[model samples]
Target: MKLGEPTLDQLHIFIAVAEHGSFGGAAKAMGRAVSAVSYGIAQLEAQLALSLFDREGSRRPVLTPEGEGLLAEARAVVDGVDALLAKARSLHAGQEPSLTLVIDVMVPGEVAARVLGNFRRMFPTCALTLRIEGLGAVAACLIEGGADLAIGGPVIGDHPALERQAVGELDLVPVAAPSHPLARPDVAPGESRRHLQLVLTDRSPLTEGREFSVLSPLTWRLGDLGAKHSLLKEGLGWGNMPLGMVAGDLASGALVELDLPEKPGAHYGLSALWRRDTRLGPAASWLVDAFRDGLGD
Candidate 1:
């Protein structure tokens, strides 16, 4: 607050220098020219008609009495601005910082890597965290204030709090190594279905209480996609795998697609659940779009 004029930018710079104790440090942190930072601080002090800092350069800038009051206010203002910018940048760059997105069990590490890699590339300064867990875990995170966004399986998610979106459809088709006996054309698809199979999800296809329950049999039960893919590649067993997860192995002839009599599948589902009563934070809104764009392909 000032008699002549006031600027949010000037106050921001002043607070940065005051907190950092150096004009150069503030400039470096804010990605602004050193001279510009110093000038902005000078303008801020002039408008307030008070010497905010005792900048005699003895050691560090000591705050004067009037500056102390302003410092408290400035901190709150700057923190608000930071949150605002994080939201704005998420919208602009199509990525969010400090986001908690729910991930499905079948969502491979590779897919997460690609999306988060692109996000970090676009917003280097952002703080992005990834939580990898089951679909139930994902839904719990979204509903209980643990995470801002989530990618949960429809099978595990039944919460009335969520607003789900159909980003893209994925097939959990069975795959095996090229050299596996059933992979040969002479072997019938029905015969292949009986061979040893690798199960990925913790819960079987029957857990959803679907009308149908005749799923193909797999001998080995594994948790992660990487392990399942590895087992499949080794000709240990056929696995109903995420198409995206086995892309590399398929292309490289390390794994061959198995023809299943009945295609046992799961829909690539995403449920964005927030407290409907509470307004969606700017960060949350931006994150929803970012994930949609990434997975919508």
Candidate 2:
């Protein structure tokens, strides 16, 4: 005799019976009659052409070897169907199924972590992807359709194709290793021009010919902020760094804040960026507000 496919109801009854160890227990758990639970299992076994339970002499039902082997597979099917239903429900509620975000490297890691943790709790069903980029690369990701939203610096703030909202600001302070001449308290402000300054270079062409807060003509351009931090600690060059990133260095005397005549240090503004033509989904909107609240201080 050819076997037939099991129905979802039959699968549920099989799982319930296996879990409860008795037809009466399964019935109570499912809010059904004991006879109905037993009949459903009987039909399932007949369709599968297998003896799923060994109820010969035991007072409670017990799964046979075949039933034990197929239990995990049944659970997987049920779990997949449940996940499908959840995604459908999220869609019905106007939530995005997935979101991609790019953030500027200048944002404090602690701030990002705190906001993202809350996001996960608030939008458990929304899938999230994250990227960390420097300067214009953050905005480039959003403008090129690689990200749903971006938290970037001032470089892309005025782009006509993108809309933005101010999120927060970071204080960029010029710093150098304690051993560097620029760190000397009596060093004249104009003397910094003679030394090499470490400056962050943009990865994308969005800011190709433009420079921000660059004070020295003699400079070493670096693509990564971390590299600049490490170089500053090594006395290789002096550069402006976010206060949040180098606060410990200044406190410990590993690095010292430089007082330049031009006052290159300034507040770096951060903003959330997205394409002007698109409206944000629920999860993305929540994220923008969360970032603003987390970093607003």
Candidate 3:
């Protein structure tokens, strides 16, 4: 804001001149008069108290060591200004500055990948933050106002305040490493309870007393699906995993599916959740639609 400080327009011209290497060429490329381009650079140099170009006895202006350093800074300033303008335009068009999403591990990876890829293309200016949680933790994030949208299982407390729609369900299969005792086809229920079971524990208190699809009395609670998958692969324990997560393992014989009469194969449906009182902006709404469409596909 100082009297001699270089303006964004001047910086843009300076960058163009630096890139093109001559006043005449920069002017021609930018569709401006050479004199105007030259004057802008002169003013910028004077304001910054630095000689940006070596014009002595040369047809094309050459950048000095100092000029090279300042050129990078000038280009950065111009880009920042352009981005500021774009953000203002996005605000005027009702696009949110940022969107936060909390997704469950049970959500199909392919569905999430497809939706997120489309989202990036559709809303390049909108900042996105993604978090992966387990079961009730997904809805807890929405309830706590920590996320703008949630894609996961149902929550227990204060459900009325949450608006949600079913997107898709994941089929979970009981699996164990090939070396685990349960990997055998004829393993009995009594024998299964004696060994350890890997289970995904809820981080939120919403499902504190409730357990779903848990057959074994002895268990190890884990929050991350990847960790459970690793332990299962290492023959540490047996547990249910989404079919997609373990499909390759199942096929490769790294893991074997267990038939548990006590706990049949189960489905965990993903729900797109948001607060009922908050109105979604363009980016958030688009994400919801994208998730629904991806699930349908």
Candidate 4:
């Protein structure tokens, strides 16, 4: 006789019986009759040509070695089917099946975490891919069709192919480690040009040959914001950082805020950006509002 493939329902029953430990328990959990549950398991075992449960001596049915071996695979099949059904439901409701979000590294981690936590609860079926980028890279991702949505800073301002909405602002303050020369009160604003500035380099060509708030010609261009932060803490260079990111360091004297003659700091405007021709999906729409509300507070 040829072997048969296990139906989804049979796999579910197999898992349910294994979890509840007996046919009666499985029946109560599944809202099926005990005899039906028993027959379903028997049918599954016969289809697979394996004895799933040993029902001989003990009052309760225990999983045979074969049953134990196949339990994980059965659960995986059931999970995959459930996910497929969920994706179908989301599609029917006009939700995006998946979204790719690129964010500027300047966005505070805590704020991102809170917004994403809410997103997970609101759209459990929508798969999310997250990328953290700096400068023009955020806008580049959206323009290149690599990202569905993005939260970016002023560098994205010149992109005409993208639509944007102001979400919030970040205060970029020049800071240096306490041990650095720039941290001294006597250091004049003009003297800042003598020291190396740890500037964030744009990975994309969108902002080539352009500078934003660059105070020093002597500079160390870093692609990663975290690396700049670490280098600043090590007294390797003086550079601007989001006030929210360096508040504790400023307070603890690990880093000192620079009193630059140019100005104390500038507010970097953050905007939610997406392709001009693409309509915002439900999850993406909700995310823009969430970022606005979360950052406003």
The residue-by-residue lDDT of candidate 4 on 1-297, one tens digit each, is 788899999998999999999898999999999999988998999999999999999989999999999999999999999989988999998999999999899999999999999999999899999999999999999989999999999875767899989999989899999999887776675888889999999988888888877878999999988899999999999999999999999999989999877774799999999999999999999999999998888
Best by lDDT: 4
Q: Write down the TM-score of every candidate.
A: 0.58, 0.88, 0.88, 0.91
Model 1 lDDT tens row, 48-139 = 88888887856667788888878988888878878787768666865444566667766656656677677666555556666765535566
The positional error of residue 257 in candidate 2, measured at the CA in angstroms, is 2.5
lDDT of 3 by residue, 70-187 (tens): 8888877888888889889999999999999998888778888888998888787899999999888888898888999988775453498798878777788999988887777766
Worst 10 residues of 1 by lDDT: 205-214
TM-score of 4: 0.91
Q: List the residue pairs that clash in candidate 1.
A: 102-150, 102-151, 197-218
Model 1: residues with Cα > 4 Å off, grouped in runs? 1-99, 108-128, 143-145, 186-193, 203-218, 265-267, 275-278
Mind sharing the TM-score for model 2? 0.88
- What's the count of clashing pairs in each model shown? 3, 0, 0, 0
lDDT of 2 by residue, 77-96 (tens): 88788788888999999999
Worst 10 residues of 4 by lDDT: 181-190
lDDT of 2 at 145: 93
